[model samples]
Target: MQKYLILLAGCPCTGKTYLVNQLQQQFKDSFVITPDEAKILYAESIGFNCKAEKEALEHKVWQFYYGVLQLYMDAGKRVIISEYPFSDKQKRQLSEFAEQYHYQVITIRLVADFDVIWQRRYQRDRSPERHLCHIMQHYHYGDTLENRNLADDLITKDQFYQVCQMRQYDQFVLGNLIQVDVTDFTKVDYSRLLNELKQIVKL
Candidate 1:
């Protein structure tokens, strides 16, 4: 049987990295790919931070990651991709790619309270060359409670949350896709989550 692919998606500071690391400790054979790591590699190689140059470099970085993912899947290895797969477009593309390789793809979406996320983002440290701090600050400003009421009307927060919560393993068993919410992790029962995943993947 081909190895499975676990794709973790979430906003910045949502603990996707932590979860991936934990899972890797448990599953020694799994391969992991993280976009931030790719970005750092690309930045180091190409001297990132210049406006036009950084944009071009980032594009190349993602292209490289996509090719790397395909290479791993072709080798029949279990790969765990950690990134913010935020849109239907990305999900559809990844799903089609996995299907082409006959590899089962399991998507896990991590969610936390906005306040918790914002606080984490605020405390995160970034390299001097990376503008992530500024970017995150901007995101926090827009998503803050003071601005959320105004922003909430412009978007379907609950629907989006539900989508993230329900899109993981549940979607896969339906012969489609899978989404799980890691919100309330402190109270979450990991054993139940593991059992549900095993059933979905028939492990």
Candidate 2:
């Protein structure tokens, strides 16, 4: 099995974590690198509660994210799994990194029905994480919702980031399978995904 970076590109709340968990268990050698999770763990270890509103904390978390990513990528060889909403630019950067390290890229992009995703969010516990409504606005807010904010005198970082995420999701679709509905996501269904990947990746 050749070393590869499995990019879990999808909209938020599309079960990337669930997919990563299963992948890690199936392939023990795989290094699942989740930037957000890593940042959270680092914060907890340091007795800090990193909030998005805090620019300094956000920067620190990103520092850790990039630092950890470079650290893992520097390691000899392993399957690196990441659930990032990768834009075209980021994908290009990833390609360059893979070329530099002689590692292949096997992206396992996942997607879902919008309504289904919204329902799942309602079933989950309340938290500071993304809300279904926010995600919906982010994904589909290209001309309609974005125009309202873009017309404003000043564009907030939050608005800019939301637009970036939407573009990234669009780029992912152009590269990966067309909207594979994961509305009724299950381990059995995930098994099919794995099997197909095993064929392509030959890992």
Winning model by lDDT: 2
The per-model lDDT (C-alpha) reads: 0.57, 0.57
Residue-wise C-alpha lDDT for candidate 2, range 104-140, written one tens digit per residue = 6776666666556555544442333432222221221
Give the number of the best model, judged by TM-score: 1
Model 2 score (lDDT): 0.57
Tens digits of lDDT, candidate 1, 81-178: 44554445356657777888887777666656655665555444322332341233122212223323232222234544465456432233213244
- Which 10 consecutive residues of model 1 have the lowest summed lDDT? 133-142
lDDT of 1: 0.57
| TM-score of candidate 1 to 2 decimals | 0.68
Span of ten consecutive residues with least summed lDDT in model 2: 134-143
Residue 55 in candidate 1, Cα distance off native in Å: 1.8
Could you give me the TM-score of model 2 versus the true structure?
0.66
